[model samples]
Target: MLKIGLIGLGPIGSLHIDNLTSGAVKDAELSCVCDMRKVDNPKIADIPFYSDIDQMIKEGGADAIVIATPSFTHFELAKKCLLAGKNVLVEKPISLCTADAKKLEALAKDCGKICAVMLNQRTTPIYKRIKEMVSSGEIGKVNRVSWNMTNWFRPQIYFDMSAWRGLWKGEAGGVLINQAIHNIDAFAWIFGLPQSLRAWCKFGKYHNIEVEDEVTCYMEYPENMTATFITSSGEHPGSNRFEISGDKAYVVSEDGKLKIHKFVGGSLREFTLDTKYAFGTPETVETVEEFEGKGGQHAEVMNNFVSACLGKSKCDYDASQGVLSLTLANAMLLSSFKNSEIPVPFDDELYAKILAEKQASSELRKEVRKDFILDFKKSFR
Candidate 1:
């Protein structure tokens, strides 16, 4: 059996534990769990638990490691695990910066170890079908793509649970890094990366966080194809919808349903019998598809990672793919902060310069107080 070690015991980490122990991996066993907090659950009672990750990896005798820690720590932890000669599965937004992500990718290649990212949305049947349809030219040339994902709502209590909740220096970016990363990944999966991006984001709009809460980004692609991404954490009764329009048909996802409107040949009667009606005449037909699954993206991600470890399949969201989405997110944030369009294949030098300036700014630096640092450290412990 493939022995595995899981780090971090937060919500997502707990979900991975459940999946690993709940027969999600027929040939795998969760031999060890390393978290700062003590878990008393019966599921993990017999397994080894350690506060130090490196010690647990050495003493617990695990063949692979799953890093479910916060986004900022992903790079360092994943690197450490890979250096120890263990396969790794890290949660999304692989790292806070693109350069770190690239370095990890190169390290994994050198070590010849499996490195995967938890982008579970790609495993959904609905999204997979949508990708197939788009790839097969069922929609012809895509003219426009729009995603409205504003349904994410996290209260102050959720933020209060950790000091690194919404600060740029701590969590990197705001909603784009935390809540919208999945959608951003999905967009890139369905439609390739954009050549350039222009965005406007509101910092500390609803909550008292230092990161952004509302954002609107415009992505430009070749051949005049464009996409608009609109998201907010401030609105209630929000909606999650996506619309893709092409020359032959259009697809829309809303309220857990996918509707496709395709232009087909007119019916025999319509073509034979001349109808004077203009507005009532129907030239297209609509089809709706429904899907049902665990709905928890984390579970799906874990299952894929385990499958990859067993050589049964490959990871749907590999670390390299995750880097693309993260790069796009970083570009958007940089564009919003600079009030200009940021070119893709991101300018690392410009991003570094901006980060340095932000870190040195006295007004922004004041937000990281002693209490904030304590709370942030508590979560990692």
Candidate 2:
């Protein structure tokens, strides 16, 4: 059996502990847990707990480590775990910058250890089906993609719950990196990376924070394809609409439903060229699918990790795939910061330097409330 150690006791960390102890994952047991703060829970009353991660590493009980710590600490903690010869499963936005993320990826390869991230949204059935359809060319040659995903509404008290909630030095970014990264990852998973992008970001637009809470980005892909992503954390009753237009079909995913309209005549180019009339249109068929369950979510991801560690199956994905989401978020922010379109695979060093500058200039603040309780399930995408 693969013994898993979990770090951090924050909201997400608590969720991981519950999932591990609830017997949801097969062939794995919670061997130990570590956090800087005092851990007081009956769930882990019989389990080993450490205040220091180094101590946990030295004791050598767990074969794998799950890092659910704050975003800023991901790199160092993951590196330490990897160097200590432990497989790692870290939370999303692997690191603040692409450079550190890439370094972690390379080090994991060198260390010969499994390193994965918690991009659990990929397990959602609707998205999985969409990816399959797109990859199968049910939607042929995507021409345009637009997503207005602003359902992640947050109040001031939400940010006030933690000191590191919205600071660049703490969370690295706001909605783009913190809340919308899963969507960005899902988008990249289905559509792949874009060539260039222009973006606009509004920092602390609706809250008393130091990072972006609203963003609009326009990206250009190869073959004359384009995409638009708009999101905000301050909008209430916001919509989560994603649309894709291709030569043969158009797809819309929203409100836990997917709608596809397939063209009957031929490709749009062919129809346009062959039609003699100026207002000619092609015959189309529409289909809609609704989802009631959220799939396995975090539990599914951990199960995959355990099976991969035991060589039972290939890992669904690892931290190496996490770079694209981070890169996309960084590029959008960098474009807004410079007021210019940034290219894909932008200079990693430049992004790191800019992040360092922001951190250096950051005026960290204290949390307004320490007893605020959070329901992790409510935050699931």
Candidate 3:
């Protein structure tokens, strides 16, 4: 069995502990857990617990380490794990800055250890089928893409539960970085990275947090295609719709269903060129597909990580893939900060410097609630 050590006792981290201890992940065991504060969960009562990561590392029973701590601590923790010759699976965004993310990725490579991200959405069938549809040319050349992912609503109490819940200095960003990051990563994974983007962000729009809670971004892709991303942490009963318009078909994903309208006769370009009438359009066929379940989610990722660490298979996703979405997030945040369109691989060091300035000047105070109960299901998309 592949031995695993878990860090952090938050909701996601707790979920990981449950999965490992419950035998939900094949060929893996939870050797230990670490958190800054003492964990009182009975699920891990028999497992070794440490308040210090260094102590856990020095104990050295785990073959792989899962870093599910807050966003700010990912870089240093992951770096330490990799340096200790441990495979790592870190939570999303990887780090608050792209520069740190790159360093962790490079370190993982130099250490010759597996480094993965908790991007569970990658295993979802809806997104995987959508990727195949678009990449297989079933939707022709993608002309435009739009995703309105505002269903990630968070209340004031949610931010108050933790000191770093919604602070720029703490989480780096609010909705885009924390909540909508899964969708953003899916977008990048399915459609590939954008060439440039322009964005508008509202800081503390619907919440009292200093970071952005509302954002609208327009991204430019190659082949004359474009995409728009709109998200917020303030909207209630919000819509979660992703639409893509292609030359031969139109695709939309909403309410756990994928709808495709495939045009008959020919692609839009051909139809426009050879149409007999000025206002006539091509015939269309519609197909709708609904998905059930969350495609195994976090457990599936951890299982795969275990298999990778055991040399049974290659890691389905790794830190290298995690960096793509981080780059997109960094570019959009930088674009909104500069009030201009920014390139895809924008200046990572420059963004890091600006984030440092923001962190240095932040004046937000928090009422950290150690007694607050966490509801992990509500946080899922």
Clashing pairs for predicted structure model 1, backbone only: 36-381
Q: Higher-lDDT candidate among 1 and 3?
A: 3
lDDT of 2 by residue, 1-381 (tens): 999999998778888988999999889999998998877888889998899899998784999999999899999999999999999999987999999999999999999998899989898999999899889987898999999999889988787877788998888899999999999999988889999999999999899899999999999999999999999999999999999999999899998999988899758778878989899888889999898888888999999999999999998779767887998999999999899999997989998999999998885565367677777667666
On residues 1-381, what C-alpha lDDT tens digit does candidate 1 reach at each position? 789999998777877788889986567789999988897778899989999987997998998998988776898999999999999999877888788888888999899888889887777677787799889988877889999999877665556556566876667778899988888888888898999989999988989887888999999999899999999878886888999887677789887688988766424244326656554544788999888762546666766677787888987767888887888888888998889998898787677677656645412233334332223322210
Over all chains combined, what TM-score does candidate 2 have?
0.97
| Arranged by lDDT, best first | 2, 3, 1
Instruction: Sum up the clashes in candidate 1.
Output: 1
Stretches off by above 4 angstroms in model 1 are 265-282, 294-296, 356-381
Residue 219 lDDT, candidate 2, scale 0-100: 98
Question: TM per model?
Answer: 0.88, 0.97, 0.97
User: By TM-score, how accurate is candidate 1?
Assistant: 0.88
lDDT of 3 at 255: 92
Query: Which pairs in model 3 have colliding backbones?
Result: none
Q: On lDDT, who's better, 1 or 2? A: 2
The superposed Cα distance between candidate 1 and the true structure at residue 331, in angstroms, equals 1.0
Span of 10 residues, lowest total lDDT, candidate 3? 363-372
Which structure is stronger by TM-score: 1 or 2?
2
